[model samples]
Target: MRRRTMGMLAAAAVAGLTVAGAPAAGAVPSAAGDAVTASVWRNVALTGTYTIRDDEGIFAAGTYCNGNVASEGWVNEVRTPSVWWETTCGGEIRVEKHVSAETDAGGGVMIYVTLRFYEGTNDTNTDLDAEYNFNRYVPA
Candidate 1:
C-alpha cells in the first residue's frame, strides 16, 4: 500500500508539471515586445522629392517601384555610411542593409528621395506630370 501511494504521488506530480509547463491554448509566443529582428518588405511610389528619417531602420530590405516613374535616392545607414541609388520606370534598386542594436543606436537611418512621372523613360523629353513624397514608420 505504501509503495502504491508513493507511485501515485509521483505520477500526479509529473502530470502537474507537464500541465504547468505547457502554454495556454491559442496563445502566441513573443519576445517581450522587443524590436523586430526579421526582414520585411516595403513598397513606395515616388512622385516628388522628400526625405525619410527612419529611426526603426525597418526599411532595410530596399524599395520596389512599379508603374511608369523614375526615382533617385540616397540612403544613409547610421551604422555605416550613405549610398546613392536610383531606378527608372519599371525597374528596381537594392538598398540592402541590416538593423541591430548598433544601427538603432543614435539617429537611426535616413533616405533622401526624388520621384518623377514622365511621359516615357526619357526624363528630358517630357515635362514632369506628377510629384509626391512618402514616409513610413514601423512599430517596435
Candidate 2:
C-alpha cells in the first residue's frame, strides 16, 4: 500500500506539471509584424487576426529590454479610432479591434492598421522612431 501511494503521488505531480505547461485553449496565433531600433534599443510589434475567418484583429507592441521609455501609436480601421499605448520599456501592450462588417457583403473587408513607435512614454511626432502601416483584406 505504501508503494502504491507513492506511485500515485508521482503520477499526480507529473499530471499537474503537464497541465500547467500546456497552452491555454483559444489562444490567438501571433506573427511578428515590424521592428525598429533606436539608440541601442529595439521595439517590436506583432499583428494577428482573431481567426482566419473573422474580421477581429490583434496588435501588440513591446520593448526588447528593460529600462527605457517607449510608446506605441495604434490606429485601427483607419480614421475611425486611434489609441496611444505605453509600456514600462520591458513588457508589452496588446490591443484588439473589430472591423466593420459593411464591406463583407461586397465580398471582402478592408482593414487598415498603423503602428508607430516613439522614444518616450508619450507619443510625439518629433520623437517618432518608426512607423508601420498594414492594409489587410478579409474575405466574406
Candidate 3:
C-alpha cells in the first residue's frame, strides 16, 4: 500500500510539473535570471588565402562581428580564435580551444597556424600578400 501511494504521488508530481520549475538547455543562471548568448552570427566567406603582412612590428586584424572588410581576394584570418593588430597588435582578448575526432574517417592534412598575422615591418597592410594553407577548418 505504501509503495502504491509513493508511486501515485511521484506520477502526480511529474504530471503537475510546470515551466517555472524547469531550466532551459545551455542556459546559465545569472543574478538577473537565466540567460543565453547567441552564437554563430556573422560568417566570413572563406575564398582564397587570407593574407597577413608585416608593418614595423604589428599587423592589422579584426573579428567578423558584422561583416569582415575584405578586398580583392583575401581578408583576415577569420576563425573561432579572436586575433588582433598592433605592435604585437592592441587587444587583450584570448581564448583556448581543442578538437576531437569520431570513428570512420579517412586520412587528410593537418594545418597549424602560428603567426596568423603579419610580421609587421612593411608600409601598409596591403600587397604584402601572406597566405595560409590549411587542410581543414573544422567549425565549432
Candidate 4:
C-alpha cells in the first residue's frame, strides 16, 4: 500500500512539470499576424507580413520584400516587435535592415521598417547607406 501511494505522488509531480513552465532557457517562441504591405518610392514596392501566437508567451515572425529583397526574420522583445535579415542575390541590391512594431493609441499596431545597403570589405571598410524607411499602420 505504501509503495502504491509513493508511485502516485511521483506521477503527479512529473505531470505538473510537463504541463506548466516556460520552454527551455534558450527556446524561441513565434507570433501570428495578418497580411500587410508598405510601398516605398516609385522605384520600389515593399510587401510584408506578420504572424503572432499568444499562448503561454507572445512571439512573432514577419517578412518584408521590395524589388530584389525578400527579408524574413523573427523578433520577440517583451511587448515590442522587430525583425532583421541580410541577403545577397548577387548582381545588385545586397540589402539588410530592421523592422519594428508598437501599439498605437487606437488599439492597433504601428510598424516601421528600414533598408540598408552596405558598401566595403569586411574588417577593412565599413560604409553603409540607409536606403529607405517605411512606416505602416495595421489593425489590431
1-140 per-residue lDDT for model 2 (tens digits): 32343234323322322100111112222344354322111112223211111111132232232222223222222234344233322222122222221122333434444444333332232454444444545443
TM-scores for the candidates: 0.24, 0.31, 0.17, 0.38
Ranking by TM-score: 4, 2, 1, 3
List clashing residue pairs in candidate 2. Answer: none
List pairs with backbone clashes in candidate 1: 47-131, 47-132, 48-132
Q: How close is candidate 4 to the true structure, as a TM-score?
A: 0.38
What's the lDDT for candidate 1?
A: 0.26
In angstroms, how far off is 43's CA in candidate 4?
Answer: 28
Across residues 12-36, which tens digit of lDDT does each residue of candidate 3 receive? 3223322111111222344566665
Best by TM-score: 4
RMSD of each candidate relative to the true structure: 27.6, 22.1, 26.1, 23.8
lDDT values, one for every candidate: 0.26, 0.29, 0.24, 0.35
Question: Ten consecutive residues with minimal summed lDDT in candidate 1?
Answer: 17-26
Decreasing lDDT order of the candidates? 4, 2, 1, 3
The segments of candidate 4 whose C-alpha lies over 4 angstroms from its true place after superposition are 1-83, 89-93, 122-125
